[model samples]
Target chain A: MDKIENNKAWFLVLPVFVIVAISAIIPLMTVVNYAFQDIFSPQDRYWVGTEWFESVLADDDLHGALIRQFVFSFVILLIEIPLGIALALAMPARGWRASLALVLMALPLLIPWNVVGTIWQVFARADIGLGGWLVNALGIPYNYTSDPVAAWLTIVVMDVWHWTPLVVLLCYAGLRAIPDAYYQAAAIDGATPWKVFRHIELPKMRGVLLIAVLLRFMDSFMIYTEPFVVTGGGPGNATTFLSIHLTKIAIGQMDLGPAAAISIIYFLIILTLSFVFYNVMTRMGTGERA
Target chain B: MSLQLQGIARTVGGSIHLHPVDALLEPGLHVLLGPTGAGKTSLMRLMAGLDAPSAGRILQDGQDVTGVPVRQRSVAFVYQQFINYPSLSVFENIASPLRLKGQERGAIERRVREVASLLHIDHLLDRLPAELSGGQQQRTAIARALAKDARLLLLDEPLVNLDYKLREELRTELRALFERRGAVVIYSTTEPIEALTMGGSVLVMHEGRVLQAGPTAQVYHHPASEAVAEVFSDPPMNLVNVEVTGGTARFPQGLELPLTGHLGMLEDGAYRFGIRALHLALRPKPGLPFLPARVELADISGSETFVHVHAEGLDWVVQEEGVHEHGLGEPVTVYLDPTRLYAFGPDGRVRAAPARGRGG
Candidate 1:
């Protein structure tokens, strides 16, 4: 076992290690530098210490964006995970229907993220798109560009359409992995379809669902493209999410020191939660099957 | 009610259709034996009502059950894959049937424990299937089925994954258990000994067709054809690879085996012969024919000897339990009952056609 550790088999990972460190570490140092020191120009700088960090933390704009991010993550998890699972269930397990459903789902995910934003941007405009025209035709006085609730709903709907397929794909794989014998046993047990889903399908998918939840949470929290394109944080900052707000402060305001501080805190929030999710999922597997 | 399949056929994957089959079964422990791709599992599936027949109908107690859903079939199947809920504890797996019917908690617990005890998996009730050994998981799966209280039991090679010794012991116990309960069992297996030991009527299948169906003893003693004879033992009942010509069957290596007995299917001339190694008695038993031979080789099983013989210009093999005095190269005249000869025609069918009608 000791010799197994010393096998310098790490030679295989040496190149990967170097690449990751170069890409991740170098940018991280730059962020750290801007976080503590004021960079007014290319050649002039002064240390602002925690002044910018405190100001950014105290700003009501930051508070509002943070709340929106949290709510968006929560709402997406609520809607997408279950809806995706339902879609996965209704999908045929094999044959033409299965492949067709897979291809249809895959089409959405294959579109680039920015393209997704542009598509939704045009699709939700009342003067131009079918969806906007339908809502107006229904006379609900809906305007995603001008109304906060409409903007939030539009963003959530766009995210679901774009990402629910990922959850469906994962859950579909989990469902397929279950051996037919289990269903045979369930049939013998007199389980209705509902009981089988609750007692078997639900538990079997818990592990994958956790992963899906964490991924969707992270993606939804850091959402910057679609909402940004649709509203551009517009109608007086009603649709402004945290990442979009951060970009405005960091790039639009050109205040690197405060933006850097805000970004570090933002990174920490994601890092902490993602770590917790990963730790919990891995530990659960260890306590059970292994 | 006994499970019955009369002229049932099913096609798998839309392209592969099995031959139409008929099976009249009794309420006893029946073991369906065959080789790979023999449609044994498909037969069990039909019996369990998990599948519908494409050609003919199934009748249970004179009731057409061809369209009965699996849940209403009153038949329990223990699948070969041991597919219990991996996330549920052993007790939950066993109690699922009771729980599904809204059985009182106390009664569910008692029944689950009883079935668990019967299958010898009571101690592992708290553990999930993934936490148990292959054998233990298999027992939980069996226990779950037992607790279901179905009228007919269909086992699709349920113990195939078990170690050899455990399989033998469990099979023996299961046979007795099913018999004592008077529960009809339709079991499918790829092993001949399992069918014989279970001691039900045997249905020998080959390539989606039942080659022979009868009592275990009858099928073993007089298999309908070389194809049926192949299901009798492992590595199959070996053929001498000789052909009947004139009055004698000749082998390439300077041996002429006389046409010891006649079969109707052989066209007055050429054919092949087969015999189960176990059925070839070493010592003469009253009316049994003894073939003169030498011990060419011995399969040294710890408790039994399987002797290979070169006899009368033909090489044949026999199994002798608790082999006491057999030595390789020792000249021995092993017995073969003339009445027990299994002859096959050139077209690979039982040489003897049904003399009158079907014989029981």
Candidate 2:
């Protein structure tokens, strides 16, 4: 049989190309243009190559925020991944109860980000908030507004409350996709509960775990609205992550050139880290096949 | 060791999966012969402690283990669908049970190697299940089951998923491997040839009930009822309603045969006569009745040909020795061997079984 050549399918993707170019590429090129030069006005501009990039790289405040961002992402991942898996394991496997539990678990993820932040802000206030009042009632001196540690703890807990369900949903789907035969075989093999979790459940959930980790990492790294509403990056720059810091430089100070440079760097950092994460995880997943 | 199922029954959401069944299995290979939806897997699951019987108790060597969980039972099951730990190497897959039992590392390695080599998959031990072929994957599963060294090994049509050649190879290898083990192996298959090939004892099941259980040849030669005979035949035994009276049998469509041989002892009444498809030959033999049949469809499966024909106002499948072509509506004379006809009473019990024979 002779094969016929047809390239008409390429034409079908033309609309998507046009839409992406208009939506993403155009704005990104404008940012790249700003990164390499200083703009005074629409009429007056000076091209200062590498100056903004160098200064943005050397800034001490950006470095602190970067470190804080990394620590926050790492801490949340450590807590949420295990906690989500535990909750998923405890959930009912089937019935109306399972449906109800799923809806309840998804409620936190369904809340808007800034609303979550605002909700936590008022909910953590020592004067009127129930959580804050309970902590004070227990004789613990807690105030997120003044204390740096308390603010950091509040933001972390708030993020955990908002996002851990995403992990639970992902891991639950992964756990459900595994066939019942594997568990039966494991039972017949006399595997203990811990060993079953280690060898069967964990390995089977590798794909969704990867998705969960990447999603949590990317979302927590680029966290802006929640912290902006709750802590406003306050209390001695403790909760001021990369995004909040970048926002201060871009919008508050109105320095587009340096802001664009920081934006490009931030984008590259996430891209590079996500790529590394994807490669490591995929390699781990298929390591047995190799 | 002996595993006894005492009045075992299973009902799920008001649907009966298995009726009450009682049987004692000794340390040897026993074939569960039944078609799909025949509750072979249900019975095996109950016996392996995978599912608790809704009614009765299962005893292992005279001790009740009905409520005991599958994890606590010394049993292993190989499913029709090949199941192995996808993330684990074949070596680790086989070593898993041993490690779960907290055996020493050296012993685990040795036992894994022994079973892997026995299944002819030692060279592929380092490969994962996804990296292996279907036959190799099933071999790995069987190897893992072997490494467990359970007292009761239940194989639920393990070879049913493999190709014909691979199934043949694995079936022979498994029979030998099973013979050396002391495990009471219960191998279930829908194929009658497979049941006969793995000849030890055979339990014929239908509609979740054990119709007959006896030595493989005895059950094959003398099925307790028409249902067992039907379930035990590959192409399905051709049954013809007949009236036997005055030492003469009258079949439909004016067919008649003298009741000589073992069929001569049957009491005169309405009965069903059964002849296996293999016994219904195309060529005429001496001292046999030539029953005219119209070919409905002729199917040549592999080496043998199955010629479906309408004879005596009933559809019959004739198992020819080799490839034979017959057009639709073509008339063919089917030779009925009187010595091989089984006589079943109105209640479906075997009134007179054929004389013990060599083939079939």
Candidate 3:
């Protein structure tokens, strides 16, 4: 059989290339351009050549925001992964109850980000809100508006409530895809419930668990709107994550050159972290034991 | 250990899956021979306590264990699909059951290696199930079951997923393995050759009912009904409808044979005559009754030949040893010794004595 070399097939991909260039490449190149130039006005721009990059890199506020972003992502991951798995395990395996549980678990994920933040803000208000009244009545001084620690706890709790459902849904799907034979075999082998979970359920959910971790990490790392809407990045910057800080530099302070440089660095950090995570997870998933 | 099923039945979604069944099984290899959907797996599940019977109780050692959970019972079930802990190496997979029992690590390793070597998989211990072939994965599953040393081992067509050569090899190994093990082993298969080769008691099942059960050779030679006969033959039992008037039964082609033995006692009416493929000889022998047939197709499978013939509106398969060629649409004469024939009444129940007799 002769191999067919059809160069005309490239014509079919031309539209995709055009769309990507317009939506992604051109905007990225504009950011790169802005990162190197100091603009006094629309027409009075000068080449700064690494000056903005150096200043952005040396900024202490950006460093604090970076560390806070890391801490937030790591903490959320630690809570959500195990909680999601437990929720999935406790869920019904069949019939109408399974369907009902899936729908209820998906409710938080379906709400818009701003709406979630608004809901939490009003719900956590110290005055006239049930949650605030109940917490204060319990004698734990609870006011997110003035206390940095309270504000930080509220944000973390809100984030978990909003995003842990995504992990639960993923892990649930992974759990459902396993054939019944494995469970039957385990039962026949006199396997305890914990052993069955450790040997069968957890291993089978590895792929989806990795996917959940990656998605939650990226989403939490780039988190902005919820905290902005709730605390306005306040309680004296207790929850001003990387996205909010970048926005403050670019839009609030009107420092485009340094903001663009900071944006580029932030993008690199996320890319490197995601790449490292993906490689490590895939290796563990397919690795052989000696 | 002794296992007994007392009127056990299963019904799923308002349809009967297994009719009420009663049987006592001792420790040995017992083949559940039936076609697919014959309630073999359902019955096995009830005995293993994986599923509760809708009607009756299951007893082990004369004690009722019907409502007991599978984990509490000393039983192991191997499904047709090869199932293993995919992330665990073969060693760990085999040791999982022992570890679950809280056995010491040293004893677990020793038993795992023993079963692995018994199943000829010792060298592949470190490889995960995903890295092994279909046969090796099933072997690992069986070895795991053997390592558990459960009192009752149920295998539901465990070799149906493997290639032919691998199935043959494992069948021999399993036959030997079950013979030595004290556990009550119940193996199910749709293939008659497997039942015959395993050499144990055979339970012939059809349409959710047990048609017959006895020693493998006895059941093969003396099936209790037409269903049992069909379930016990490979190319299937060739059944021809015949009319009986006096002391002789006449075939559709006007050939007559004397019904002088136990067949003589049956009422004169429409009866079905069944003969195994191997009993239908290709050449005419002296003193043997013969039937004329038109060859429709001849399938030669190396050592054996199956000749499909059409005669008097019925299709007949004749098995001949070695290579025998018959051209399509050719008229041929096939001989049948009347003593080896089976007589069934119009209701599909066997009438003649099961054992062979000298030609009269």
Which numbered prediction scores highest in TM-score against the true structure?
2
Clashing residue pairs in candidate 2, if any?
Answer: none
Q: Report the C-alpha displacement of residue A19, candidate 1, in angstroms.
A: 1.4
Docking class of 1: acceptable
Model 1 spans > 4 angstroms off = A1-14, A39-51, A279-290, B12-16, B241-249, B258-268, B277-341, B347-360
Candidate 3 lDDT over B46-136, as tens digits, reads 9899898999989999999989998889998888998998778999999988888899999998999999999999999998887899999
Alpha carbon lDDT of each predicted model: 0.80, 0.91, 0.90
Please report the candidate that would top lDDT against the real structure: 2
How far off is each candidate at the interface, as Cα RMSD in Å?
2.9, 2.3, 3.1
lDDT minimum window of 10 residues, candidate 1 chain B: B351-360
Worst 10 residues of 3 chain A by lDDT: A281-290
TM-score of chain B alone in model 3: 0.95
**DockQ of candidate 2 (2 decimals):** 0.45
Q: Candidate 3 — which residues are off by over 4 angstroms?
A: A1-9, A39-47, A285-290, B12-14, B253-267, B277-340, B353-360
In model 2, the runs with Cα more than 4 Å from the true position are A1-10, A40-45, A285-290, B282-288, B291-294, B324-333
What is the per-residue lDDT of model 2 for residues B168-208, given as tens digits with 9 covering 90 to 100? 99999999998998889999999999999888999999999
In the order shown, the candidates' DockQ scores are 0.32, 0.45, 0.38
Q: Model 3: how far is A215 from its true place, Å?
A: 1.2
